[model samples]
Target: MSDTQGKDGLAAATGRFDAALARLDQSLVELTNRVQRIKRIEVDTQRLVQERARLATELDKTSARAKRLDDSAHDVSRRLVVAMETVRAVLAKTE
Candidate 1:
């Protein structure tokens, strides 16, 4: 090949190589950014899971407390009815 033709071919090859390298670098940057975003999402998912467990535990405790309160209310109601019945009997005897 002629010297001029060879130099021109070499320059063209170098330009193509440089363009390919730039594209590779851009791809790497985009990949890195995507990986970072995925890591953040994983961290957030773990945090939300912990929060859900804590909320579930709290809900269980609240439900148990509510059940106890309901039982106590029933007990108080039964006692009040018995007291009223005794009062009525005493008032009837006097009448």
Candidate 2:
């Protein structure tokens, strides 16, 4: 082959290599962006998990407090009934 033909072949090969490199670079950029988005999603998921745990703990404490209040109310009601009965008996004796 002539020197000119050899030079033309080299030039063509170099052009193809440059195009392949550009495509590879673009693919790498896309992959990097996707990875960053996934990382952000993971962080959000972790935050949500922590919030759920905190809310669950609060719910448990509030339920216990409500139960205590209910018990006290019943105790008060029982005491009031006994006092009313005693007053009725004393009144009957006076009558």
Candidate 3:
């Protein structure tokens, strides 16, 4: 081949290489952005999971407290009934 033709071929090849490199750079940038977005989503998901766990723990504590309150109410009701029976007996004796 003539020197001129060889030089032209080299120039064309170099241009193609440069274009390919530019495309590669662009793809790398896009990949990096996607990875960053994924990381953020992962962090958000973890936070939500932790919050849900904390709320569940609070709910369990509230349920236990409610159970205790119910038991106390039942005990009070029993005592009130016994007092009323005693009062009725005393009134009958006096009458």
Encode model 2's per-residue lDDT on 11-46: one tens digit a residue. Answer: 999999999999999999999999999999999999
Backbone collision tally, model 2: 0
**Off by more than 4 A, model 2:** none
Each candidate: what lDDT?
1.00, 0.99, 1.00
Off by over 4 Å in 3: none
Better of 1 and 3 by TM-score: 1
- Candidate 3 residue lDDT tens string, 1-95: 99999999999999999999999999999999999999999999999999999999999999999999999999999999999999999999999
Residue pairs with clashing backbones, model 1? none
Clashing pairs in 3: none
lDDT of 1 by residue, 1-95 (tens): 99999999999999999999999999999999999999999999999999999999999999999999999999999999999999999999999
- Report residue 15 deviation for candidate 2 (angstroms): 2.5
Top candidate, metric TM-score: 1
Over 4 Å off, model 1:
none
Pairs that collide in candidate 2 are none
Clashes of each: 0, 0, 0
lDDT accuracy of residue 50 in candidate 2: 100
Candidates' TM-scores? Answer: 0.93, 0.81, 0.81
